[model samples]
Target: MSHTKLIRMTVDRTVEAEPGVGPDIEAWRRSVAGVLAKSRRVSPDELGERPEDLLAIRTEDGVTIRPLYTSADDVPEQPLPGQFPFTRGGDPLRDVNRGWSVMARFGVNERDPEAVNESILAALESGTSALWLAVGGDNLPVEAIDRALKGVLLDLAPLTLDAGDQAGAAANAVLALLDARAREGDGVTDRSRVSIGLGAAPLTTLFANNYSPLGDTAKLRSVDLPGAVRLAATAVNREETIRALMVDATVFHDAGSSDAQEIGAACAAGVEYVEAMLEAGLSIDHALGQIEFRFAATDDQFQSTAKFRAARQVWARVADVLGARDAGAAPQHAVTSSAMMTQRDPWVNMLRTTVAAFGAGVGGADTVTVLPFDAALPAGALGVADSFSQRIARNTQLLLIEESNLGRVLDPAGGSWYVEKLTSDLAHAAWAVLQSIDGAGGFSATVESGWLCGKIEEVRAHRETEISRRKIKLTGVNEFPDSAEKPLPVGPDGTVPDRLAAGRVFRYAEPFEKLRNRSDLHLADNGSRPTVFLAPLGPLAEHNIRTTFIANLLGSGGIEAVNPGAVESSGLADAARQSGTRVAVICGTDKRYAQEAPDAVRALREAGMTSVMLAGPQSAYPDENTDVSPDAYLGAGIDAVAALAELLDTLGVR
Candidate 1:
């Protein structure tokens, strides 16, 4: 459980109010003002120039997180558990008591049916309660579904498929497998425990491939209604628990959609499916019952939990709008974000996946698949079952469920003002987006029109900017990188990633990864990696901070920083010469720069340094006529990728 009192922003003030609480609202305001005045050491009105501005912070989705929430905030009417709107949760008790299903992706290599069987069996034998088999292309061969699931007790574990273009074939293969493997003599198979979720996500295909699954973008706008209806009717006839339609947000979320964007996309997609199922003649309840939602559970615990909660609540509103009352209770499936997993310092991924699983479980996912830490690695790169990372990933889910006992609490994030407000805020934002999609003629129309990808690209562009500017921190790649650790040989020749062929993939660390690859290749070819000389302008005290800043910045791109200890301005050229580095970074305080940088930069450029960088804001240095202004500035918001790329190009590392 969480201790909210520690985090809640409260005031320390006492005032006697009317016994019936008349005018207590004013008293509360006074209390807040008193606290602010004391903290800011200012008058109540001024409060540090603009005190009200500090009360809220804006998110990527344009929702403001306020410092306080009270009855005055005008929140939308929240519903009871299992009731209309379902803001509290879809079900009264969501995945509590028993926890979420511990599912694994169960990657298979060699396109061999036997290899698939080994992977599934090993995962199941080691605490996995469900399977997420990603078939088609480089993943599990679609033809090997039966062989992969061979010997698996259908009564024990549920199976979900991410077969991309082959969803229909994979769904049929699952049904056939259950028919042949889970039965005896002439009686039907007891498949109540066999939860078969088929990703009938045409929108996913459209966004991922721009309509390669279907004939063209025009066909993508038209859902295969007959196929979906047939699958729903089959589930109804087989007397099995099969969710025929999947509203998967994992693809979009990993593609750099914001929390509200992913939730809105899934809700809108689910709405499209509901329309199809209803058109197929199933009742609203059954049509909704056949649908399940899948989203990415990331390491941002609060956002992950809030996103899951928002997904359920927003979809409930959509269902309500569609006249499916009980349909609000959607089954949520969460897999940790594969894009967040890093190839460098892969060991830290255990922490990432574990927290994500916790958030998914707490957020009310029915099933949570913790992808292996080396999930970024292609299968067989580290041998069968993805080596020890797979085992650790399984144990991560197990420990959270069994030892940590996260499932014992019902709606653990409920009741907190922060979480409740965020949940409601996300729902409203996501519903507006869903309405926009509906206004644009649903997922199919929007995707076919390319408007959907445009929204995603907009978000992706912002995210890429932040990532390159280091405004968004990636632990091992851009912050505290471990140079001693061996890099994971996890890609296609350490360059082109094969995952884009598998699904809609986007990674923030791709630029740095490419830089690392170049660095590795450079080292292999020249017997030494690219080096940049840090020419400090004074004693260590005068330049230590800038020196460290520049080194860490350059180090992020796998560039070796050659620090010729803090030297006089006169020795700057000699230091660059002695280090034999083609690039030099000037590090000093602004005052020191004003006094020494112009001469030092001139000398270094004269010494044949092709590219010169200054370690401060671009405005920190005055314009000079001596041609000593830095070629580039390495500061807080500068693009790390562009900076590193320029340095590498100058050093001839390409």
Candidate 2:
């Protein structure tokens, strides 16, 4: 059958289609309601007015994702790609066959300039189209720029720099190199073909450094802000394609800001830079052209896609307000989030980065950078990504673009009801956040006054709470943990580097990783992980559900759960003793719990069990069985981190 006919047949099978008539959406909804009612064992009337919300999900950004969407859903009229506001895309005639620029990030270790050069050459020779070089402070020395770019073709591959506090020196070195390449007439016939990003982000620097020198005008001016702007003006005068500044919202994202907050903060920072450049004697168009916006692409695919679209819409509004409506489409670069990478089971990061890259591509990012999976590991002094990891990172983009053909359509997510509505909602929400920031004396002022950090902290606290309750699952760290997995190689001292930068880094799995670290130390000292005795009160059919539940929960904290078959209350004490652990958990069905839990708890306690937990909720016990209480309940929605920490302490694991 033809592909079109097969798709039509599939849709026909999904909906209730009358013979010789079209498929009916109302019939489809009725069928769905019937299925839900039968599965839930309730009358169809009991299903609330909005049955879609039954499967709806609420995001951390306060956006609700409904179960289904149709044309009836309310959303603003969307224009074609490359239209005004540029929400669909920045270019109407984008080459569908040519995908986004695959950018590779290399942290230039001053101690190993040769290694950095080798990696850069390999990346460019492979599939990478651009280079994001971290230079200056704690990276490659500014003077070593020449050696780093020794064999690179400056005109072909784009170059971006990350130089904190040394933007002037770094820009000069790069510009000088480009000049020499042009003077030598070696492959650089046109300077406009060469793209360079100076990466001078003053607002990001202030946030990372805790708003240092705030309220001191002289000290603030003494920073590299003026020099960065002047360098950008020089690039414009020389007719070179160099974006001298960046509005990097990844700083806010790593600090745990929500999606709306990241977009709003980025827009505010862009406005701040525009005003500064205008004050430095540059036109609005030149200022906008000299700046690019960077955002974090996360594992949440739909949200990440919507975030980029919403960011473009909101930024266009900002530019229009500044009297630059014709040049409102902001250049965007998306990088996989560093905060989402986990040290334990770091291999899963590959899946996360793939999804993030897909979202960034569909969201119309100009460039995407996938950080290596092992970038968070402490293998070397600087944790440099191995060549294998870098190869995988670049190949991920290649597969998505070449094999999957993900870049063959412009605004692939456009015209979908759900994506359109989400884009509009996110745009409005982010605009509100930007308005608040502007009202509070703008981005820099908010950061200096601690307003931005305070708001981000509130969201972080809530997110952490959800993570502790397992509402937000970290696949390897907090869910399906492998206590027996071999540890990844570490540094010479076998220590993970302290990545805390002014308390701005907030890794979602850090709390659970800390508990695991303690467990590792105990195992190193005692030759066994902390053990928990799981007492099943009945046959496998009666207790297997809770048995698996409690076992996985305990394993998340690096604690082993030992099940010695089904033990009667009389044998509970002996089984506990055989396990050689002071902590125990009772696992059984509700009916079994009401019949035998009290005796089981009594037996374990009399045999000197220090702490006994039940694998169900406290309300599962009958009202009259007040004696059926375990010390703690290990069920859903409980704070797993706190409970595991307490169990480790009680068992002398620390």
Candidate 3:
């Protein structure tokens, strides 16, 4: 439960004479003025900086938060814990006695049963609270499954299939195998602690370059799919014990999202799923009960923890709105992000995952899964290094659980100013966005209108700008790029096992909602280009960057550089001719621009342009080596005015 107090700023405390017992308002004013004269007045400078006019920042969800919050921010009508709404927490103290579990996944090689057994044994020895076994294929090799179950107790969370893969066949195949095996052992299939990885399949289908089940039969129809995902979920209910379900955040970062966007998107997705299932005949309790989330565990601990707390408030509000009879009022699961992990300095991922895992635990996540650091680089090439990364992540969680015992406290970050403020802001923002979605007639409607993707794109654009400008420091990638570091090795013979492909496709969609928000690739730099065309190639909202940047450049150069609407192939020739523009500089990011640069350059050349300048780099150029013959480029931190000046000199703009 939150214990912070907010104070209200008001003049109500100032003394005033009562009408019945004292003088009139005029007399009171006169008296106050006389008292004020006794105090010394200060010069203009002494007044210090005046506060900016208070403005409310509204989140995409529609939750409004003021610039400042005080004691008056509390809702007196809001119920306390252990009561309706459960806004403070599921319990008054947030169920602090029981800490959340640390879940670890053991990779099973279908051909090597012994290796699978050893991996699970190592995970258990390393103090992982639950066993997360990522099955190799559709048919769970009985031997591999036995290895995972060898010494693991029935109460422990079992190996489960990930749903991030859109192929229903993979999800169904794992479910069928788990069901078959469970029936052979316990006879009551419901007594197994396992997850079928049903969440986020839809979103996963959108990003996968390969096969996707969400596509129409026009694509591939050979796969037999599950009618409802929860049927797989219900198959291993585990009686009274809460079973783990996967809620992944990988796609969110990969999709090019911000930390706040990650939390907001995940919360929205979860709400949609819960509401949808409930409407389709499942009880609210059962719907939330059988679910869990898997978020990208990045290096940003505060934002990650805030994501967890924000998720709880979102769920709590929904529960209050529903007023369900037997619904447990807790946020289900929190998965860490893998987007920030780098293949360059693979060892650093351990520290990154540790921080992310801590945030999840403190933020009230039911379980935390830290993806291995080297996992970002391929699977087997750096096999030993990847194993170390995984072990380090596990050890970090164990050390926290046993030594620091941070998990022992509920809302450990409750009263702190920073955490409280972050929580309040996150909740209010996410809530508002949820309300907006509701007003728009729910998830499917918003998706149809492209409203959901639009919001994500907006946030993604801002983050991209920050990252490009180096406002956000990714240690090895940008901030402290290693000059002497060797490139991460790829798989031997560059051959990757097909099983990994299945696993990659099987990630939950909710986590990817934010993690996948990353731009497809990094942008190169623009050295000096007079006419820079900022074409936001991919699925991003255009911000009139061409005009703004060119205007600023022209202003510095004592010339008028024009931006001709949005630069496109059809109009490039006309716009350039009409505006008397010469060079066209492309200024989009990797995700969108990298794939579109070649065509844009070709079209520009055919339109009679002599030279093309890339505002970013050749990395974003469509054809790697086939030069559109870009003459110059500019990266983050380059002086915009300087770059433009150089370009003007080249173009004889004076």
Candidate 4:
């Protein structure tokens, strides 16, 4: 064959359609055009008017959730379960026989060993397949593992430790228990079930110093990493199938990290550990096997699902590069996020926990730990799983596995085009950040440099801004808050580890709590909450929505809104004075505002109202176009915190 002929043959193959094909994408595109034409597409006068614009919500992780997904969108190759990438799952069929382990946290009060023993025995007997004991802290003696687990069978329930800084000491105590139990002839039949989270992410000890000057001990603290890895080797050396170390992505997540940041930091930490383990003389498989990845499952259902799937994808890729394809299947343990928990309406936390648990299950977590409804409450406010709270937490899994039968299908969210696309997007985004962290000399090094701390603070500011604006609503605190609710009583207190980490575990609802506290202090001093008067200018229906909106807005900041009933424009000033509030918001429709708001706002301003706000947009009654204008606007788009602060200042509440 001539050279020209060979080139022609190769070029012809590119354009040739040799056989029958599936449905035509061009035909679908034409159909979509027809549908849009027939449906009479509306004009996008506003940004959100367009379907794509309205639905394309960008997450902090830098992933944009599109309105619709299709086959045309680039989808990652769907590897079978337990395969490379491990996006579908690592233990392919594990959930079918034994669904995710019900690992409930059982905090021990060693001062009262009898109560602690009874609690542990009761917890194991009642649905809990594993125990995550608080090993450090004054409540749980660092060396009293055997005493706490006296009645509990070591062979049955898998035991994990959260020993804080004393993690190495705690693991030694547990190993001692295992040795003593072996002498008693009750040994682990399948060591695969045994896991001790000797995961001392020493970086957590240096984590975030709350945007302050870096301390001298901060970078120096993670020196414990080598000791943690060496301690982890003991289990691997014994031929035990226990996870010795952990990648605590939740620490980053709870510290206000975006989903991608959390996973990226985790992968970075895992890679750092892998390198350290290789240098420490452990084989790649042994090193990978000795570690597990832990992530927080938040109430954002699909986000959490994408999070777990993406985490595994990133870890699998990391492991694959390290020449351990089998070990790439990252074992995951998910717990409901503490950052999503609340303090005021503690009961609502159950719903949040349930949703998080469901997401964790759907996300294919190997072990799911649902926090108690009262988990956010102080130890004095809650004991080792109050009966009601513990039952609810455990039953969250029961409802999903037994009742909902969620475990029947392997990788239930596997082929979903949305989930798959989301998982791919999340994986790539997280991996990019992970690569950046690697470039900066790994996880511990990032902490030492305060790069991770700075990154976290940026996200924290964004989240706080959203919360303060009420753009992200907290059901009880910022919306339908219970003003009359009493504070939940705390349980007996215990000493928390003086963790070297100088960071706050931020929640979106935390700012609201501060606002609520200010309100409490105001009430105590003045015998009433800082109040806003509703100066309605029209009928009930016209003014009710805006009035209620303003009320909720001011109330979100712990200020009360007083409505002296809907009234005409002429009576607004009298009603404002009768309501006895300095902040008066004109509430009415645009049409009514053009008719009556001018007089109402004018009257309230002349009637000694210091801060006169309009419930609706200020553009509705522009001073250039009308007789009066509000001093400030109190509406959907305005920053709630700033508005409330100005209002409180006007009211002389603080």
Q: Candidate 1: where is the Cα deviation over 4 Å?
A: 1-56, 67-81, 93-97, 110-115, 134-151, 163-173, 176-194, 211-223, 379-385, 485-503, 623-627
lDDT of 3 at 215: 27
Candidate 3 lDDT over 107-198, as tens digits, reads 54434656666776777776776655544343334335555455555445534444233334444554555555666685444553343344
Which candidate ranks first by TM-score, i.e. highest? 2
Cα lDDT tens digits, model 2, 1-654, are 999999999998888666788546667767777888999999877886655567788777788888888768857667777777888888787668877889987764554677788878988888898889888666888888888877988677788988877778888899888878778887767789788998888877677555321122212111367777887788777646889888889878888889999999889888888888999899999888888889999998988999999999998898899899768886789999878888777789899999999999999898999988876665442345467777999999999998999989878898779988888889988999999999999988998899987887788789999999999999889998887866443334333554323245577887787777777777777988889999998898999999998888887888889999876667889989989988889899999888888888888888788888889999876667676578998999999999999999898976
- Candidate 2 backbone collisions, by pair: none
Residues 412-490, candidate 4, lDDT per residue (tens digit)?
Answer: 8877888888898999999999988888878888877888877876987898888887888788888888766653332
Q: Lowest summed lDDT over 10 consecutive residues: which window, candidate 2?
A: 213-222
Runs of candidate 4 exceeding 4 Å displacement? 1-54, 73-77, 95-97, 108-111, 187-193, 208-223, 379-385, 487-503, 625-628
The alpha-carbon root-mean-square deviation between model 2 and the true structure, to one decimal in Å, is 4.1
TM-score of each: 0.85, 0.91, 0.58, 0.86
Better of 2 and 4 by lDDT: 2
Q: Give the winner by TM-score: 1 or 3.
A: 1
| Candidate 1: 10-residue stretch with minimal lDDT | 213-222
